[model samples]
Target: MRAYMQGGGFVVEVDPDEIEAFSSRWPCSNLTVTSGKEFLFSAENGDILDAATVSRGRRFSTEADDGSALAALADDACRFGAQALSLTDVLAIRFPDLAQAAPRP
Candidate 1:
């Protein structure tokens, strides 16, 4: 998985076949994207709260509109395996440039 900024919003690109490694069951969001697809979320404001792609499936995200908040959410996803990893975790290694921008805990 990889994430980057595009047109003021965040775009998450997920590979459809790789989701099984992260979760046994499909995500709750039920959002689907093409294999190696990119989903867009506006930075300014939008109705969508959370969104993710998993093997052509989907999941949730935070409702905050702040760009930094969104970046932090992505960071949390990247660190899914940190301590006690859960099935709901996104299980990404890290974001590209956004990883550097996200504040460390």
Candidate 2:
């Protein structure tokens, strides 16, 4: 995962290869959901700030991708500030069910 501040806003990009590699090893079901749970707990405890406005990006290709993941990251960035986040965080935010299914260590 790549995260940085750009154009006065935060940006996070998860590499497709990373996703594949991680899934091959831990799998979402094998990896524990500690990070996701911790993040949510922190957010509930007032660690996260208010959400920011997210704008839809114009589709550059005819692919069926809806960019919901991108929007989820934007919302988190706005709420959590520019602190570093991980692939698990992204997955947790975008695919809560998968994260919740993560195996306990």
Best by TM-score: 1
Model 2: lowest-lDDT 10 consecutive positions: 32-41
What is the model-wide C-alpha lDDT for candidate 2?
A: 0.34
Q: What does candidate 2 score on TM? A: 0.28
Q: Which candidate is the best by lDDT?
A: 1
Candidate 1: 10-residue stretch with minimal lDDT: 82-91
lDDT of 1 by residue, 33-95 (tens): 233333454434321324543333544432322244334433443342221222121222233
lDDT of 2 by residue, 32-81 (tens): 11121111213222223222221242213212222444334334433333
Model 2 spans > 4 angstroms off: 21-63, 67-82, 85-105
Would you estimate the TM-scores of all the predictions? Answer: 0.34, 0.28
Local error of candidate 2 at 38, Å?
24
